[model samples]
Target: MNANGPVTAPPTTGPPEHPARAEIDAEENLLEKRRRLVLRRLKQFLGMAVAGTLLLLLNDLLLVHSSAAPSLVVTLGVFFTALCLSYQGRARASLILLITGVLATVGVVLWLEQGIRDSAAVMAMTFPVVVSAMAGSRPLFFTTTALAALVLMAVALGDITGLHPHHVRPVRLSALISLEVVMLAVGASIALIARDLRHALHDAYQQAASAREARRQMEALAFLDPLTGLPNRAAMAQHFEREAARASRDQRRLGVFFLDLDNFKTVNDSLGHPAGDALLRQVAEALLSVVRKGDVVSRIGGDEFMVLVPDLQSDLDVPALADKLVKRLTQPFHVDGASVTATCSLGIALYPDDGHDFAELVKRADTAMYHAKNAGRNALRLFNEDMNSNVVEHLHLLNGMRQALEHGRFELHYQPQINIRNGDIVGCEALLRWREPGLGLIPPSRFIPAAEKSGLIVEIGTWVLQEACRQIKRWDDAGLPGITVAVNLSSVQFKRGDIEQVILNALDSARLTANRLELELTESLLIEDSERFSGLLKRLNELGLTFSIDDFGTGYSNLGYLNRFDVDRLKIDRSFVHDICTDTHHQTIVRAVVQIAGSLGMAVIAEGVEDQATADKLLELGCELGQGWLWSPALAADDYAAYVRQQGRAAPA
Candidate 1:
């Protein structure tokens, strides 16, 4: 199943029954064998013909007193030498020599001695028919047979008149007629047999060819993707292995890229699968067009492809190539009469640099690809040592998160959100903090994204919502000042279509009023289709639950949604706040956001106020609510309760 070796279909040549080469090669072998068989038999028969003719000439010279013996012997010797010396494997040359030797020796003796009355000369003509039959050529057999009959008839006419050299007796005339009739019957039969044999060979070759074609089709199915007409993962694996070895031997660089189409599932879900398929085909063609002739591009799985860059000039050039390929793939594709653009993230690893072998290289490339996706899609990353360590850390964090959730090793910290005008802790954002068994106090930044990507965010987010609700309800029952407790929700949670139910369940189980709980969602969440998500927001709002737009002014926002939906507050992103004191643009954006909120009759909260100057500017800007280290860092539930009690007591009565 690991196809990282040579996957190209090799040219086939050999016997028909070879499992790899199949029937075409076998048919070729059969033809060669037949040709060699005919050549060998023809040589042996020619030697016999020469020896037989010499014996006949010697008999005529020593005993029969045949005057044509000398000329016939000389001609037969010359033709026999030519046949033995010149006919290598050419059946045509052998056949021609056979006919020439037979006619010259037989005709000379027949005309010089008894013409058509000579039985020996007539018998000598039959050898050529046998040789021609064995050559497996029907046309040659028929031609040789017809030539022998014509010569015999010519001799008969010469013997008919007194002008003939030998006298034709009536007793001998009937015997010569019988011999000629038998020769014609034998020659005709051999020709018919050769013709049938040729047909049978032709039929067999055709059958073998058909079977080979079928096998080739099966191989194509096994190794290629039908939709893209590209090699599959199995083929890619095979190609990688072979190229790796060749690269090592030749001291060449080989680059392997792990590529994944970004947001392809959204296209499939929004459009139809047929559109997605057409888009994939277009992508494959684009990728192939951008790569080198020696490079291989394969579709390993859904929305995932690999490009094997063999014979690279240098490992340093891989990034440039990868970038070019990514750019090519991101071009707009016209599918189903609609213009659609899909980008890809690629991770590249070179042979002997990232890994010495296929598996190792692919693993590194895959790791790097994940990093590229995390960094943001439509990019490429070359494998590095840090990526490996990050991979290890990510895996450790992912595994630890699962166990932490199960054993209640995770806890929530409350960061106080104070009313800037009155200096009262109006509410607190419930932030998640993890304390692993050994690794203490893991930040939300480190594991939150990982959890979301791994789909553990759904469970983790649910726990956060429920635990925060329960803790706040306990605070209320203990007679402490009640404040709105906000739990941040990941965009992934909303995708489940059951986020509203989850929120209701947490509030009901905690016996807390819906109005006391606030759910925070990022600006990206609002960027989604308003019609699809607006209903859920309205339903949640009907339950007296409120919402805040978190990390505002950091992403593309349809600011109209703030008013269209029941948004109560906007938390200015920390990036703008961190630089607001120094950067005019940040200050202007903050002022604009505050103005926009005030016009819409919504509360605005600014976070990351580390100093009094920044806090004073927010107050001057009409921002009412804010939280930062200026108050205190986020605290555990018990610590937060103590802090709240302490702050209440210190307030002037």
Candidate 2:
């Protein structure tokens, strides 16, 4: 399987070179080397054969004038047959046949002439040994050498015993000994040289193999994710370039899907890093399973993956792929005997439509992915121009917020929480408001998300806590009625910021009671790590601080945590309260919350109550406290102070 593509099949080979192809190439190279060796030896043999045949013909017809024609013709026939065998690729057989024929011809000449005393016949015996050595076969070279020695010994014995009818000259012992010594030296020298050549060839092949392996490993390290074995960002970029070029040439669409696992950090924190790694690997598998064969799936670091879908027939094909990914990823993954369910937010960008380059496409896809996350995770969003505008605005807002935090342009507004039955201002929820120099008052909805995303919310939340405490002290100094001041806590502040320390510092510096400062936390934040948060809540509760679930019923309203943490209040979110007077669904939710809160000995406060009828309905539903336009919108510090004083004077004791 290719790392650049889907990993549904087990990897049989890596990139750049497949094992089977490399093996075939190596086999072909070896065969070519053998072919060259055989051809070179055959050429040498052919030259020697031609020269020997001509010399024999000349000695028989022009010089010696003996009838050696039959012997010469037999030699020619043997040479032709060897040449035919070599051409048919039977190199070893041809070599053996050629050596045998040369030995037979030389032995016959020695017997017919002076036997052991024939100088030319003894010299001719060296041909078979030399040819075998040239063939690079150690066994064949040694065998031919031994055969030549036996042939010499036989010729000497036959001559000495008068077994050769044609032997007329007596063999000289010194001449025979000198010839045997020369043949032995030549054969040994040739054998040693052949052995050295083989060793050098072996070493060269080994070095080449090592270099190839090193290059393959380097490529794997550069392109593949260590954990998931998927193509990483660098490989993805290369794949994108190739796919993009093809799409442009073919006039086809290419979709880039950027995937981010929702609440992945929570998974790491809850399941530990090992389990998180396992989860990521499983996610990679699921992604590969969803994509087509040619599509590319890459792990772009830290729970983020990119899928490049090429050769898209039409835009209609994109959503089906995206939906498949979302559905497949949202399913439960079993890791270390634990069933962990993960949902991914996917953002898609099309080639030549959303972006023209890899980086631009990825950026746009990332922006769209964040939009999917913001639209509530486990969804897919296609890249659009408006998302880019929103992204630009978000960047501007993020930058502005950073500046505002540094320049002290951020402030809090107090919205009065009224008692539904007595019309008394029971408490006021602190709302964060930003006043930029030229932009006027920037609403929380527009900038709060940007702040949260940029991690400025932690510092900003600290400021809100400190400022709310100071204002509460200022109101007490002004001799106003003592009421709880509720400040909203961001999940980021709770997780990353030292909330307990910041709260303690604020209350201590302002000399305000902790109970008078209520921390409004969302249900999702509380349920994230309940056991850890339970301990923190317990510690804060011991410090005489009050805790309320803000924007209740808008999240996973798990009552198990409410009882576990012992929360003091549940602030009903404005959505249900806005239509509680008429919408039966909203009314039912309110009633359920009121009943649940009442059973748990917790106070329920309704937010976004705008009229007397809504307030009356909340009161009728057993909710006594309400905060909305019914009493007053969130006001400035001075306005809230004046409003409190007026409410105190107007109320009958």
Candidate 3:
């Protein structure tokens, strides 16, 4: 019920009509037409009955001078009275009375009237045949015509025998016979016309029924998946809106379950698309069977199904229901005479919890389903706040990083590398940094993950290389001693076949020598695709460019690559150097790295050498290069240039 009394259904727009409903509608229309026809005929009969009764009473009391007047009068009055009575309830009964009245009037006129030839009585007796035709009944028309024929025969016998005063000579009898023949022809015509009318009505009814059924089929095809007979994604979206509204009104939880079939591609690959389609249909049926009455299971697209549970008693109910579905869907199904088993990964999101709207809920549920697949197939997971937070933050970072690239929000800091023997300045490593306007100085750690995840690292890393080379050229032109500037390369950038082109463009644009610019890479980058990495390194090395493995001892320390490739130096990871003076493990690893560098004809640079003791230990261990807070932390470009000039003045030229 709505705010009004009983709720009324909205009028149907068109098609997809239920077969039973269509039949009921057609029957109701037929019944209504019949009711109206019956009522019309009954009124017409009542008018004829009233008028005939008055005309009979007047003729018997004044006009007619016959011995049968009273009998005819009584019969007409009785017949009229019966018609009026039957008209109150039964229309068919009133029609019967009218037919009987015509027969009775003809019989009375012929038997009682004397010497009545060419009288109006014969014409009046034909009224029943006309009335029967008007009533659209072939049975009544034929019955009245037969009865009238018998009456004519009786009148002809009466005239010949003089049993009544009415008699006809042969010449007048011929005219009367002609009149009977014309009336019979007219009755036959009316019967034939009525039969044709009935056939036309039936044909029209059948056509209307067929058209309605075709419309219903078209509507079903639009919203339903033809193969599986399940509501499609479009229909599911509509269902979600309606169910969400209802859940909001009742303050109930609505659970959206996103299900994806596992190993379905294997079926398509091995058996054929026909078998895969059959498997999808079986899965749809299984899901439909397990859901409650109010729940809707829809085939979203290809091997994926969405179930919307509109009302739940508690949030806890979602897991048990999901488990039941997973168990049921995992059972073996027969397709193309072969038994196959498939599993589903399900992710659930609740109304007013995971999301308040349809799209959000679907996305979250899809994400959770992906997590379930990652965890292992044939499992279920519910969306949690942690997932939402992480996804939202990642999205924010990706957007911000794009904006930062276009607007010149990035900065580069250079850390000076020094010689452990003479404390002489050699070269500095350029590091990329970002300082968002409002957020202020976002470290590389904060934004690098976003860049890497979005594949923006390639573009950003290219910019870093170009800027680092350009800075090195500016410092060299400023009367500072020529120093090699090392720029770190992201694994994504290093793997591209165009890396050498990007490097040459940067060096040419900055007007710097290849040896003065070194490319730094991590051990993992080399280990990922070593053959490709080695070929790329060889090509760049042939161009007079230098290469170093950055943050060594932290990743796969494959020493064989150092011997196979033309590498110059190793920047020891800060993890070992930060505690080198105190941790014995750090001392031992540093000694091993220095020995390996000697064996491979490479120089070793100790990074994060923060104290005099760590520096002294590196020099004693035959590692001649180092950089840390002990010398100076990484500084802005201009500040590093000032530090470089000061260091040059301090050195013994």
State every prediction's TM-score relative to the real structure.
0.52, 0.53, 0.46
Over the stretch 260-351, how does candidate 1's per-residue lDDT look in tens digits? 99978988888899889878888887787777677888988899989998887742345446655876776799888888998898887877
Whose TM-score is greatest here? 2
Model 2 residue 542 CA deviation in Å: 1.6
Each prediction's RMSD over C-alphas, in Å, is 15.9, 16.2, 20.5
lDDT of candidates 1 onward, in order: 0.77, 0.80, 0.76
**Winning model by lDDT:** 2
List model 3 lDDT by residue over 238-309, tens digit each.
888998898899998788999999889999899999899878878877887677777888778888999888
Assess the local accuracy of residue 354 in candidate 3 as a C-alpha lDDT between 0 and 100.
Answer: 85
Candidate 3 runs further than 4 Å off: 1-353, 356-387, 649-653
Ranking by TM-score: 2, 1, 3
What's the distance in Å from true for residue 398, model 1?
A: 2.2
Model 2 has an lDDT value of 0.80
Clash total of candidate 2? 0
Candidate 1: lDDT over CA atoms?
A: 0.77
Q: Estimate the TM-score for candidate 1.
A: 0.52
List runs of model 1 lying over 4 Å from the truth: 1-206, 217-239, 242-354, 359-387, 496-498, 578-585, 611-613, 648-653
Ranking by lDDT: 2, 1, 3
